[model samples]
Target: MRITVGKWFQGGSPWVWLNAGAVAISLVMVVGLLALIAVRGLGHFWPSAIVAADYRVPGQESRQVLGQLADSETVSGERLRGAGLPLDPSLDVVERSLIKVGNRDVTGSDFAWVVEPWLQDAHYPENVMAVERREWGNFYGYLKAVREADKTVATGDQAWEVFQQRIARALAIHDQIYQIEKHDIGSINARLERLRLKERGLELKGNATPAVLAGIQAERAALDAEYKVLEQQLGKLYVAFNRDSAVAETADGQEVILSMGKVVRAYQPNAMGLVDKLAFYGDKLWEFVSDDPREANTEGGIFPAIFGTVMMVILMSIIVTPFGVIAAVYLREYAGQGFMTRSIRIAVNNLAGVPSIVYGVFGLGFFVYFLGGQMDQLFFPAALPAPTFGTPGLMWAAITLALLTLPVVIVATEEGLSRIPRSVREGSLALGATKAETLWRVVLPMASPAMMTGLILAVARAAGEVAPLMLVGVVKLAPSLPLDGNYPFLHLDQKFMHLGFHIYDVGFQSPNVEAARPLVYATALLLVIVIAVLNLSAVAIRNSLREKYKTLEV
Candidate 1:
């Protein structure tokens, strides 16, 4: 029981405690970061009570303001005075707040900073309404009246009900118009482009006969007729789109008319109960994930980005797995333990440490420019000069990521192979099985869990990569997904949106900083969740494989 300090140090208890302490610290930091992101991001969906206040700054007239309180900070009085604000000499610190006054079209600003002491008569009015628009950010005001064209349809207390009904009608019409334009007309446009390509392709090969030309012309004419019908329907829908308008009185008491067709939704946060707020929050959260982005990606859903991120990761996994496994097998089972093989293994390990951006540059140069350009010239000469495959797209992005993650897979697979008892392989060969047969049936199956582990690591790394994707395929906004209902459904040559890239664009490239900030947090959280789900799925498969082959290992 009387152990000396030197004896205790020799026992290694301190090192064990040190390692556990380090792990605990790391876990706390990770959990704390995720908690912060969830709070800041998910809190954006909950409706906050809009405050109406009379604010007056030094050397300015007092004006009525209506908006949500976004954030607050304490600053030195000296700093405030340096910014030309008059403050008491005795004051050491002052509190300032950022308000999201969302009449961007009228006031020409999305937010305004006010000194807390100068804010007078701050209150939440039940009559105040927050309108989510398809354009111009958000509109905060009081409902004045509902009008159909120049005629007043409803006024006073009934205008809110009438406005809601008209908004529902407008949204329904919008959905119909969206279907016609994006789906039906989009399909026709794609077909027409293909026909043009076909004609050009024939001309290049000196095979454009009169009958062939006439057939192409006939197809074009049929598409034109269909387009014309959709065009007429769209013309009528446009007329309906702007049919109803709502008159609203702003915080400044100026009346502005907003088309019901342009309104996404309207809410009175001051009047909403907990249940109503929860419903509103759910709707907003769904829209953030399912709807198309609007207002320069500061508003709307990131469904396209989500689709592209998942699609590219799946493709990368498919490309990297087999190649990694083969290379690992060759090195571990067949290749001699020579200097050249040792050099190669060292090189492979070094490659994993190389900066990811360098891989992106290599991918852009080799995969996109060299190989894709050659393919375009040799196999798709018709699409030449336009550079179909030669451009940055989905295929190149996937290949680039696959190349980036190959080292991880090879190392993991090799380790797994090294773990398989040599006696097992010897037994398989002794039991009337050839070397190839032993590898195919016994070795590979037992080694599968390792391949899955490699794949899981690859997915974890590839899904979060933004720089390489930016150079190869990721775009700010993709008009349509790489996948569609067209022939040869998955178009790997198309550029696509990505969640990581979207977060970058919205967080840094957006003009509306305040509006984009919360969205950045929310999108980042979603990206983490996506990577987690992918890794967890891979992990589940890996565990299952391990269980199935556990007896083989014994």
Candidate 2:
């Protein structure tokens, strides 16, 4: 029998095809976006050959320009002329390249766009060095001499090798200084502060005795002594760190001296072979994930943000899962399915659609001010005026996200619970199991996969949220991680960084727009990868649960 087009319409085949096409289009768009992000982000670390050229433009003197070619585009000649550039009226289009000039201290700008037609004698110089600095961005120049205490130690043919050796030594010293300052001395300072608070508490309680006071003073003295010793060690390390410097001639023939202590890494991209470039690229990629931000968060790694994001998501899962499951169980198994129950379900569904910033406002007002303030007054009176839990921190951020995602978990779990056969429950109750036992041992195991599905959904939403976190706990830069080697291993009261906010800060709030653009893409890609890993892990567990209960459902 021939199938007519009108019959196909009645049979819903067209709708099926339409839905499949829509799904295919969505998947393609998501994949294409990921590919674009990866290309723009990962390509930033690869070493590009530095180009030396003389930029000649109409009505302006030609000057030496040195930097990496960042991007290129074709624009109308009229646009170029409107920007005060004297372009030929006969030409319809003009080609230009955006160059990363790097010497921000000298030029006051990190990037510039120049017309390609006026670029003369463009070439790569093998001796040209790109110095990644701890501040003020990168410096591009030619190696001149390596200095030790204002005296030239290596010059001419051997300066590069000597400079590299000294830089490596300086970096080692810097690491030691970091450890001493941020960890050892930091621990002592924290302990000393605790002792001070303890002493004050004793005094406030009218319990200040000579014996207790003596003990506190003794501990404080010991910590102070330790701090003094670390301070002396840091002093010596600083002296050694500042011992070496390098002189280089810029593209414009200006000689500049860069301190070895301020340099992060220096390399000649033009002189590198393919293997060398690959190794360099790998190192930079690792640094982006492991190092701390420098130069107003435009340079270096974002490990803190990554750590905070994962920690917050894990905490939110821990908080939301049990509460959501309990609520779901009560609604599905115990509650009378009447008007009140339906009303609550409707309210929950509506909550899922509430603006996220409203949650942030609620978290700040109730959680931070009311609940946390009560906690501080009840438990930590010695730290009065200086709020502990009374301010925004990690704990509040986690709780706020959990509250935001509770509706998702409840809806998903209820659906899972609804799917179980009534016969299954009757059989359990008939077999000498109580109602609670059947619900706990039989029903819950079969529905475990659904609980995990809800958790996965919650994590997917919580990880990328920036607004609520910004109000509750997230900061531009957290000097210390919420989880650290302190006495309380996990300080729930401490503020922390987040990858989503990092992307926002770097992308929109940065002063150096051109330098921050690539970092924004890289951080965004990392956030996506983090979310994917969390979802995949939950999915794996859900699949395992589903397999384990496959026969039980039957």
Cα RMSD, each candidate: 1.1, 1.2
* C-alpha RMSD in Å of predicted model 1 compared with the true structure: 1.1
lDDT of 2 by residue, 1-554 (tens): 25697798899999999999999999999999999999999999999999999999888988999999899999999998898888889988989999999888898999999898899999998999999999889999999999999899999889999999999999999999999989998899889879988998999899999999999988988888888889999999999999999999999999998999999999999999999999999999999999889888999999999999999999999999999999999999999999999999999999999988899999999999999999999888889999999999999999999999999999999999999999999999999999999999999999999999999999999999998988999999999888889888899999999999999999999999889999999999999999999999999999999999898662
Mind sharing the TM-score for model 1? 0.99
Residue 551 CA error for candidate 2 (Å)?
Answer: 0.8
lDDT of 2 at 401: 98
Off by over 4 Å in 2: 1-3
Error in Å for residue 387 of model 2: 0.9
> What's model 1's lDDT at 474?
92
lDDT of each residue in 117-168, candidate 1, tens digit only: 8899999999899999998989999999999989999999898889889999
Evaluated against the true structure, the overall lDDT of model 2 is 0.94
Residue pairs with colliding backbones in model 1 are none
